[model samples]
Target: MSPCTLLLIACLGVACPTLAGCDISMERQGKYKTEAPAPLFADGTSAQTPPDDTVAQGALAEEQAAQTPPPATPALLARGRERHDIFCKPCHGVSGEGDGMIVSRGFPRPPSYQDPHVRQATAAHLFDVITHGSGVMFPYAERIPAQDRWAIVAYIRALETTHDLDISGRPSPRTAGGRGS
Candidate 1:
């Protein structure tokens, strides 16, 4: 061993044990943060997907929402409209026509709300797409809160129903994968 390192190590070995109140508790938890990756997880993510049949804490409201959707009141639609204008309008247009400002700027446009598939889709389906994303759309689950996501779904549904109140139970050819959208 190098004499300098050996001397320093000997000094620390003696001094550290002799120091008062120099406790390093092994029981202390690590300072792991919400967004930080946890290598201990098999998937290497701090945020794990809930197991198939289990609803995570704070997620019961969303699960209950799927089962007992509230009536679409005027206030709810207004809230939905406000949220949609802020989040979805960039790619869905003010009227949900898929010809948003971003579309003019060459972003991949989302499907129009007036499409039969979207018009007939359930509110839960809208929530899933908004939260999880589909095709070229990035998931907004992190950006938009769950309630706001549901509100956007309501607004989209409003737009669809405003145009075609008769649309229901009919599957669109695009949804059926026939290549004609």
Candidate 2:
């Protein structure tokens, strides 16, 4: 109410907090935040690349039972097919040829899994793509677990093998202009 009292309140607002060691020093911003510029670093990045042999917590190496998949038994193949149909078939097609329903609906078609280049890619490489995603394709690491990704890779390999088998051993698919079986 009095001018002295009002002046006292104003002074306390600034002085008391500082005296109590509750000033805004902690709230002062860091020189940089995540992914921000860093004049101190030679590379000019706030983040530094991890040294070799450094692994992220709970990474692929730990998640997968083995870097190389186990035997592609019938059960594994079946599960692969199921997972593929659920997550991959929308973009990778039932046969892994990059012509899925989404591709038909104006989405960009992916490279065919049956391509010779794709066939040459290592299983681990395929797993990496599924985990991190390729160009234009989003990652499925969350939707498809590490094991299921292995299964999908196995299934894609199976598709490639089937296409390479002897022509006479299987009923030939009709050409585009020809009738279906």
Candidate 3:
């Protein structure tokens, strides 16, 4: 072989082994495979169970609040009105008639709270809708807290009740109070 060819072969012989030892590939890592037996752990499993009563951060309190609704009070109604104006009014309208400015601007109108089906829906149903959303409406869960959602339900109930009353504040003829005994 030529001198240059012999010198190149000698250099490659020394460098190749050094380069091979420098491998840092993640695929060749020493991590335990999922669900595989872990001899180092007492449980002998790769996955470790969370301790008893361990709730995910920020989840326990919100979950509890979501389960039980607070009683409706004037303060709650006022907070509801403020929250409603900020979050709901744009789509649901000032009177819960589903004719907000967005509708005038060509957005789809939401169902009116005064609709018979909506009026008959339980407060829990409303809360769920607000949390998870329905139809074209997006969820407000991330934007509105659980307590505020309950307050909005109370405000909607008040709106439905007021809508059922006549201009003189008496029950309308369609209601039980105005129906013949």
Best by lDDT: 3
Window of ten residues with lowest summed lDDT in model 2: 172-181
| Model 1 CA RMSD to the hidden true structure, in angstroms | 13.0
Q: Candidate 1, TM-score vs. the true structure?
A: 0.57
> What tens digits encode model 2's per-residue C-alpha lDDT throughout 60-123?
5647553657788888888889988998889988878798999879999988886767888999
Candidate 1 segments whose C-alpha is farther than 4 A from its true place: 1-57, 164-181
Off by over 4 Å in 3: 1-54, 172-181
Ranking by lDDT: 3, 2, 1
Q: How much does each candidate deviate from the true structure in C-alpha RMSD? A: 13.0, 9.2, 11.1
Tell me how candidate 3 scores on lDDT. Answer: 0.89
Checking candidate 3 for backbone clashes, the offending pairs are none
The reply for model 2, stretches above 4 Å from the true place, is 1-68, 166-181
Candidate 1: minimum summed lDDT over ten consecutive residues — where?
172-181
Candidate 1, residues 1-181, lDDT tens digits: the string is 9999999999998897678556567656575578798899987878878778886676787656545546778888898899999989999999898989998998888889877788778888888888889999989887887777777887887776554322464545444543223
Global lDDT of each model?
0.78, 0.80, 0.89
TM-score of 2: 0.58
